[model samples]
Target: MFGLFKRRPKTPGVARLEPLGVDVTVPVNQSVLQAALEAGVDFPHSCKVGTCMACRSRLVEGKVKAIRDFSYVLSAEELKAGYILACQAKLAPGDRIVLEVDIDSQRPHFPQLTCDGRITAQTALTHDIVELRVAVDQPLQYAAGQYATLRPAHIERAREYSFAAAPTPGGDNELRFFIRKTPGGQFTGWLFEQSRVGETLELTGPGGDFWLRAAEAPLVFVAGGSGLAPVLSVLEDAARAGVARDAVFLFGARTQQDLYQVDAIEAIAGRWAAQFRFVPVLSHEPADSDWTGARGLVTDYLAAPHVPDLAASHAYLCGPPPMIDAALAVLAAAGVADGHVHYDKFLDASNLAG
Candidate 1:
């Protein structure tokens, strides 16, 4: 019955290479990046889950299937321009392909890391949010907005989550993460079911380059749902370092109930109130409630007067794809340079590794 959907026989591995200015043979089912890595070719990549378009390369020739649905990552124009993600594309047998290497100095370095940590504390931040604090056997250093993968003991799956804790005064021993419960998510489901204090969970080191850069530039941070985790860490780190750069944080949610860590953020802002602004935007609220804050989509609030002059500011956006896309358009229209806008879209494991 399922034979109708059977895939066609795959072509044999690469037979030759000429357009790429190098000779290399890529195996069937191996991605461009994987093949390049094996051949000692240096390329840029982040997230490796097709979420970050950092590894985007122009396909001068050949056809490839994306490992994941990348419609959300690239626009119609970009797709038309032959921009394919190397991490998500496998080389077609005997297909000649051209790779355009990014020469930008800002490209992130992808490192392989392995570490061990135990869940020291697991507390419910909200009904759907859980805060997990882990203490590793040995300290590990990571940038403020970087992320790590947590693999629960005996579980074959791992989940990616951003940090919510700033570097301790002079050490890297403690790490914190704010995890949101996704319906039917494997790790999230396990996190909600068996996660407890003192249970050891294996972890990988810093895997993201989404940290605070350009300390002197004015900063605008917009976060939705669990996206606040990394933003919180950056803000806290800045505050601890006595950074006086002007910064604003816009946290958006569906309702007051969806907001978390308000008091903590407010406290952090208080430390540098002269240079920090924290605003909570709600999409829906009780009509009878006495709420006077910005009410609309987070992008709408960003378009308001409170949003700073993006020309001289760096913007960090973290949220679902729709929210991030909307915010990117708004920021661009407000004069923010494309290079100054950074974002991370949460990709479901099923949607990525599947």
Candidate 2:
């Protein structure tokens, strides 16, 4: 429907998906993601519109044609990185292609321990995102800024997601996640439509080295969409530890409708009002709205006249690749040492790629 994909092959072809170890025939009429679903081999995917790149896979072998703008999600830099959006690619008829679901799985130090959990609650945080609370059977001992891999009960392939909150006061039986429901995505579509409380989901890990470093310097946090998950985790944990150093959190969204959990964030930030700042930026808001907040890309806010000094602080960013890249450029220009900044860029299959 997006008209972003080229004509698919009329004949079926073989595709071997790694990690999940699924080898299925992809019908020429259907996308690779669809084929996986048909075979009951749930694969990582978001917008089947070919916009989100949630179904991104690495071509280990074979040939194909992928039509993408390279300006949206898929880009020349990503192509060079050996990743292709499966939803946008047309497989050569009768040919076989081998692919790996994720690149990080190849890393030795990465621990991907599968854990079990049951949905305790699912709340609509906004028109697009939902806040899911899962009670795990076992504690997921991890750093505040780390993430995990999530696989819905019906999904065969697991997607990565970050922790939205720090561990509970007494134990780690419960975990939280803020998820965006991408249109045309099977997993999120079911999540927003048919999923129910008590639904069990398989979880894995305490992945990523992006956790908070020692709170020695001031901090700047930049987030986009559910990227707020891990940043909020770090902040909440810091607040509990009474480690309120001067900090600023700048969140960006396309419009007011895209923003969520504002009141909850404001409430938590109230504890450190003297040292913590929360600024939400809307890039495309209607002029008629009564909203009178910062308007533009978050990077613009970092460069604004009244912004505080960032050169002496540590910066943490979690969001789409484009926003992360832009924020890095802005921070560097503001004299924030490259080593002083930490970030978790969401180019993984976990993203709701619309």
Candidate 3:
């Protein structure tokens, strides 16, 4: 075989995002995410400031470094596993590098649009959570469980929140979100402490791949805390579509006080009695306590006796990363198809500020 010309480094560098199968140029001054987006690489992203973990990717082969750490969203083990926030990592100028983009989930192609939205109402859902209803200037085209990014005035980076109600996928202009106040986070702190209704936020995107997919099997939804947002949205969507598929929702909380929107959910379950069931689980309440219902981790309900023929079900998971991680194990043990199980792992802002 004839020898090819000796390989040499070029003046500029390139990167590859796989699974999606895309290649793009990377500049020393710009992050890999910025370069990839300019080159049209489709991936999940929110809080472009590197806190959301939406643009997380693993370094497969080449050299890239992060300007800021995302320890809150990614555990130390994951960091060692080659995960890097694409929005924060960049290649050295004139350096050769290869990258393995870690995109574990998929979403339908929807052009992300940035628009103006006004808060129509802000009602407390729990001691620390609020239901923020917004009316966008123009209708957003999104699936029931998708999320939108809000760029609050005082915050430099945008925050991602999943829709809590299902408006028409391509027709509705109103957006609902369940927001929990993070103790020391940027956006949440500002929203809880200083923000008000009748205010405007720059909304962008309808990101995420956590919506309910078409499946013949029954739907089992496991949600914790504010993670109920997308679950509720999807359930409403299913009801609106007149889907007769059986659905069981297991909502977990530390105590009964943490649970919200019970009447609303119960109403839906009652109206769709033949097809829907709602079960609220408490993790901290004792057997002697006043609450009488399912208790313990949300996964407890999936254990053998409670559910029969779990293998024939499609499971949807949403909540904090810890809950999502644990539920994944149970779902796996239950024999749900990898493709039939969809999830959205929530991450809170932690130690991102200077």
Q: For each predicted model, how many residue pairs clash, with residues at least 3 apart or on different chains?
A: 0, 1, 0
Number of the candidate with higher lDDT, 2 or 3? 3
- Of models 1 and 3, which has the larger TM-score? 1
User: Residue 287 error for model 3, in Å?
Assistant: 4.8
TM-score of 2: 0.66
What would the TM-scores of all predictions be? Answer: 0.78, 0.66, 0.76
lDDT per residue for candidate 1 within 1-354, as digits (tens), equals: 556778876764441232346655667778777676566554555567676676777776678777886677888998998888878887666676666655456433444356788888999977888899988877676677778889877778777888887766444677899888887776777778865788888988665657776547878899988889988888888888887888888899988888899999998999973578788999988867888887888878774467666667789988777788898888878788876888877665325331
Among the numbered candidates, top TM-score falls to 1
Query: What is the C-alpha lDDT profile of model 2 across 1-354, one tens digit per residue?
Result: 576768753678888998778798986666676676567654554335564454677878887666554346656877787787777766667878887776333222323356788989999877777898988887767667777777787776676678898756444778898887766666677788955678988987665556666747877889998888998888888777777588888999888888887876786688763577889999988878888998988878875443587777798888877888898888878888765777777653345532
Each model's lDDT: 0.76, 0.74, 0.77
> Best candidate per lDDT, number?
3
lDDT of candidate model 1 versus the reference: 0.76
In model 2, residue pairs whose N, Cα or C atoms come closer than 3 Å (at least 3 residues apart or on different chains), thus clashing, are 52-353
Error of 3 at 297 (Å): 1.3
RMSD of 1: 5.5
Candidate 1 clashes between residue pairs 3 or more apart in a chain or in different chains: none
Rank list by TM-score: 1, 3, 2
